[model samples]
Target: MTLKKGIVYALLIASVVACSEKNGTEHPDTATPVATVIESEKLKFTIDTLTDKLDNPWGMAFLPDGRILVTEKKGEIRIIKDGKLLDEKIENVPAVYDHGQGGLLDIALHPDYTTNGWIYLSYAKPGEGGGGTTIARTKLNGNAFIEFKELFSAQPFVDSEVHFGSRIVFDGKGHIFFSSGERGTKENAQNLGNHLGKVLRLNEDGTVPTDNPFVNKAGAKPEIWSYGHRNPQGLVYNITTGELWDVEHGPKGGDELNKVEAGKNYGWPVITYGINYDGTPITDITKKDGMEQPVWYWVPSIATCGMAQVISDIYPNWKNNFLVGALAQTHISRVEVDNGKYVKHERLLEKVGRVRMVKQGPDGYIYIATQSPGMIVKIVPAN
Candidate 1:
């Protein structure tokens, strides 16, 4: 009996050796497995390029049929279908200002898109004298935008083309929220009289909601939801909590993430952690009694551009987390929030190019839009 047991043990040791040696041998039929490097100790995913020919694509939305609509900064909307960029640009898009930081920007679909076919866009539009951020609603009908109407535009358009804080999002409660930058003028952020540097909430057809905080205030723009923002390019609505969140660019440092609430002052130039671009001090304070503070602020800024929340069943680890697109640092920031408070964050997809937008598709895959050699990449489980 002892001899039999010894033979069994010897065979078990030999089997282990054979498995370990397999790594050193070349198996021609077995393809080399792709390796994944962990980042920030929180995110583990693989980026697969869906298309790389986009020209500085700024934003993208997935169609129900699995195609994608991408907006190029040069005032064109390109479609990606069947893993190939379509030859023709979508027709009847608004004429974009297309200068400086202004141009074709964010895009979103209605929550009932499967039934209503409503598509919303935010862009820099040519106004009477200069240009400003504008929101337009249109219907997508066979490669063209039909029945398009300008839904909202920032008041007193500025001639300068920079700092168009244009991002569009919808809360489930029958309202739309959009942001507008101060157009390189910091004082406009503090003034309640102008729509610049403020987030505006509107009904689907451009009318200001009566419930807006500034609606009853004399001399204030009734559409104003929250004010005192810088160049905010990222806005998203958290469906689970029914709250809106946004990220904005800072001067030299102090990029910020704020939980947007109605009728609140975000304290831009008056209270900031950033210095001017010329290395001058913008403010001596970072806090005050009447102003709202950011949930998180990044010193030595990353120049964050776009944001999206991950609520995918496929990525259980990343569920309910927010993904921020870092343009200057060329990475995606995974931020975790606990009970509406910022808990922790980590950077992901470092050096993949300037991440212009990060979105979660309806099919549970995270999509990233990169600038420079513009491309759309999808993130999935490394498997």
Candidate 2:
């Protein structure tokens, strides 16, 4: 999967395609394009390797000064400044669990970061029972963290290592949204008493918002924005439409892309298009009365992870589409949707190493973080 310098890829739109639908039905009309190289003057891009020095890079955040902050799964925060990866890691990062699928996971800057200088992080925090997902914030001061504060920690830390559904996004309204996996416990997704397996919303200072759906519901965690999620690793807030979207991993199959709304129940174990990893049926039903269906799902699991929407016009043909990282298949899933409805799909950068995260840089270009070789690459117009 060594990507040569200045390699170009094409974007082709076919009228007929095939894709997996929410009801476990294969849409007869939609087909996922694979290695379809049709040279186009309109939609072409080249991959430029930024740096190949990272270690298991999990998430990335761009600074106003054109620097990049990347988090490695093993608890280091590295910086990419002036087009080169700095040798120094940020100092004073909090201790993370740093075990299977745990560590410093995602990084984000405050909406008012220019004035407040606040940076937020989601990591697996080690505690009494075991390790669980945690969110914290701090201000950066010359390669060191200052005014560091723990914002929230998912309760009842379990001993499991996998399924830490942690990604962070802001709504530009003084609130933060993050995901938490069920800690390998399927039933936890359905339980509201614990923070596991839910999308949480809180104020910038870690206070539960009063208008949250379950604020008054006894026995429910007040920070919960939505419940019944499996392991949502990819989350994004559409500032234009004011919608929150998440993509979570499913077992053997059934990776889901959901339109997350307040208080909605996204069935995980109770109803799934997936089965046990060893090929046993988790359940016979894929739909139930109260549970919501995904906008789209992937059979044979792409291991969907960190995602970003194409909001910038730099890539005119990709405007408003979603670029999602596929770890298992090692490609970027370019998904197109219209008004929350699934429209089409394309597979880009096939065999591109384990694509861990895809983000739109503040400069209106697409940047991708990948593992195996452990590098960051930028996509720009081939023209």
Candidate 3:
């Protein structure tokens, strides 16, 4: 579907009505939408099938017992045990709106999970006219997630379902960071007061981090660590560098891999390499003076999702690189860096449909979430 500017204008009109219903002030438009195409060599991957298939599984996290937990888009979570899919799904998940891109989003374990027994989740909590992305915590009991409670929710929720931006990861220091999507509102990306389109910092239990970038600012979301993003679904705090990294979706092109920094704006709606899906220009410049440019970006989007830092001590071939999952591109992208600069990007698993999430397993191999009639595949270097 080629998204024309007129269509984008119409979408914005509807968005304004949705926001007005909730009594938010209307702001001027920020940037135009754009569309671009990325074409690269066809790639290949090895798929180690899990025991069970899932329905649009959006997130994956391994429990200490080596059981795999995957969250489905339709609000269900399944447990995979011993390379086999368990037929019974854990119940009592909170109700989700599931409109466009919103549903059960991401899952992560607490750093002290063995002692705390906490499993964190991000989802779209259904509400009156629409919903907003929410970060919550719960405990796992057998196959079920129990004692679930909302730790934080985007306020003045809009009417659209796209761009839920629900990725969660805990830093080494026990602080949590949650990604908030720009809910079909381009102008909101520049609004410091709004919760949408920002990387937020909070304590493990969901209290605002006093050291957050905007904690003392008036009208700014108190938890905002960095601002100006579209839909940031990939977030990981690199253990080696102690830095947070995120990859986000743009309109039709302009996928980005960013080193998420404290207080800096990431330059979304205001500046993008993407245009409206209809092929119009988005921003005048790819780099602005004050706004931070991406550490690396795709002129033609890779439809990037989850990513993880690859660490290898014995194999030593793929160390210190980033492995990113691609939805539109249908591959696991390996990004290599040298001397704090992006060196190269290679694709793995070109025909595997959607590689939703990527993570390094405890046993020293990569695991991926194949969303669809979902398949969880373990990636081992062909030896």
Candidate 4:
């Protein structure tokens, strides 16, 4: 019996040697790091182009049918299916300013989108002399927006072609949070009466929430959630924690990623870590009393745009990383977060051109939108 057991042990040792030396290159059995370099001989990627069905697709929300609803800056929404851009655009899109960086911007579906049928849009509305970012809600009826009306507007904006903080997201409390750009007027961000450069919490019906900090004030606007931001292009709510996070573009530097909270003030122009385009100083102090500092900042500026939390069920290994779209760098930034702190930046797909937005699609894929006859691209894990 002992001799039979020895024979079995010898066979087990021989199997281990075969796995390590014979077939190891093709199927590695030992433990590998999470970011382990793929062996080129054992791996291959199928680069299937999906742009034939895309037209400068801006922001995309994957529909239940596996097709995508994409926005074109020229004020059109097109449908894409099976790696092809549809020529037929959904009609009844609202009129937009379409000047400079303005046009129909972000689109977000209601949290209970399947039942409510409500979709939100952010656009630059043509004002008397200038424009303001207009937030509106509409129901999609047979591929067109219907029953549409303005829910809110960023106020006191000038005629400048810059600074429209049109980013919006749904908070966990069934309320909407949107940002208003500084509009080249720095001081307007600190004012509570007007909405410029402010993160606002609003009811679904467009009225201000009663629990807002300024609701009891004599002349203050009740929708104001947090004040003093620049052109905040990125905003999202963490699904796991329900906490709101945003990233904003600063002057030459001082690009910021902040945790937006109620009633707090984020000092933008008055206490920035950035400088003017011509190297002039914008602010000296990076932090001051009674003013909130950014949770993370880019000293040289990444020209940050849209931000998305990498949920685990979708991208298993990239769970905590907030994918930041970079316009200036023309790359997607994988911002890894560790216990509410910024850890590292992993540049992904640098050759794809200027990334406009990063979003986790409902189809369990990472959707990245690019500008200039914009196109939407999907990121899938290599098998």
Which candidate comes out best when scored by lDDT? 2
lDDT of 1: 0.82
Q: What tens digits encode model 3's per-residue C-alpha lDDT throughout 238-285?
A: 776788899999888888889889999889877888988899887877
List model 1 lDDT by residue over 149-238, tens digit each: 998889878899788988888887788999999999999998989999999999987888889999999999899999999988889998
Which wins on lDDT, candidate 1 or candidate 2? 2
- Deviation (Å) of 92 in candidate 4: 1.0
Give the distance in Å from residue 29's predicted Cα in candidate 4 to where it truly belongs.
Answer: 41
Steric clashes per prediction: 0, 6, 8, 7
Q: What lDDT is reached at residue 187 by model 1? A: 96
Model 4 earns a TM-score of 0.85
The residue ranges of model 3 lying beyond 4 angstroms of the native Cα positions read: 1-46, 312-315
Cα displacement (angstroms), candidate 4, residue 112, comes to 1.0
Off by over 4 Å in 1: 1-40
lDDT of 4 by residue, 217-315 (tens): 877778888898998999998766978899999889988988888888999788898999999887777888988888788878889898888884645
Ranking by lDDT: 2, 1, 3, 4
| TM, every model | 0.89, 0.90, 0.86, 0.85
C-alpha positional error of residue 195 in candidate 1 after TM-score superposition, expressed in Å: 0.6
lDDT of 2 by residue, 203-264 (tens): 99999999999999999999999998999999999998999999999999999999999999
State, as a TM-score between 0 and 1, how close model 1 is to the true structure: 0.89
Clashing pairs in 1: none
Q: Where does candidate 4 clash, by residue pair?
A: 53-84, 53-85, 54-85, 56-373, 56-374, 57-374, 165-181
